[model samples]
Target: MRVTRLLPAAAAVLALAGCGAGGGTKAVPPTATGSLESLAAEVKCRPNMQTDADELRQAICANSDGKFILATFATDRGQREWINDAKDYGGYYLVGRKWVAVGDDGVVKALRGTLGGDVEVGTNHSSHSMHGGSAHSG
Candidate 1:
């Protein structure tokens, strides 16, 4: 009967829809390649500040050699202005310089303008390439 044929088609469509919904989505695992020394250096060199650079540097160095989690970058005017006014405090990396964000396990979760624009993560790895995006083989 036509009902039998239509039932199979309907079931197939539902199954296909379920599969499609589940597919095409991936998780971005945390990275573990960050250094506190680099972070400190960035804080020390941050522009537009009225704090005791040397003291701040020493304090940051004291806290160096540890792991951190969750980091973000800013490519907007507001964020840049905030960094300038805040003297680069807190636990965020300074962009426009080579900086990286690490996870609790010390992996590089995300990278910012350190590599320059026009590049994304998981790309190739060549010295000539920006953002560490270069072709590789194993």
Candidate 2:
């Protein structure tokens, strides 16, 4: 008789489990365009880098119109590190409702001006075998 009573309670628990009572889904934001002209206007000048100069220039110029849509930004150190590593030295800025990549070569990249995304600002500190120690992503 006791076994039968416990069975019903166990079944109830299992049913509730499927309803996602513990960890619910996160809501995705609606797609919307944000003005980047203000941001572009803020970008006074571009940095000089022989390696990825062209790519960086194009990205800066693209945002010059000051029209980009917001998406997601890095929230934690690990995420920021991953982004910085992926871009080699510089960091990435998500713009135009899409995740776009940008490179900053030491000189000022103007974070407050041209970036249009969630904006998770942080630092990345890691030691590479070949590169030794370097400070990246701010």
**What local distance difference test score does each model get?**
0.27, 0.30
Which of the numbered candidates is closest to the native, going by highest TM-score?
Answer: 2
TM value for model 1? 0.19
State in Å the error of residue 99, model 1.
9.4
- For candidate 2, lDDT tens digit of each residue in 7-122? 23222322332222122223424323323333333443332211122112122232332222111222344334434443333232343342332333111123323333443322
Residue pairs in clash, model 2: 36-66, 36-67, 37-66, 69-96
Q: What lDDT does candidate 1 reach at residue 5?
A: 23
Candidate 1 lDDT over residue span 1-138, tens digit each? 111222232223222322111112234323223233454444333222212222121111111223322122322443233334332222223233222322111111122222221212221122454455655657
Q: In model 1, where do residues sit more than 4 Å from their true spots?
A: 1-65, 69-75, 88-92, 96-138
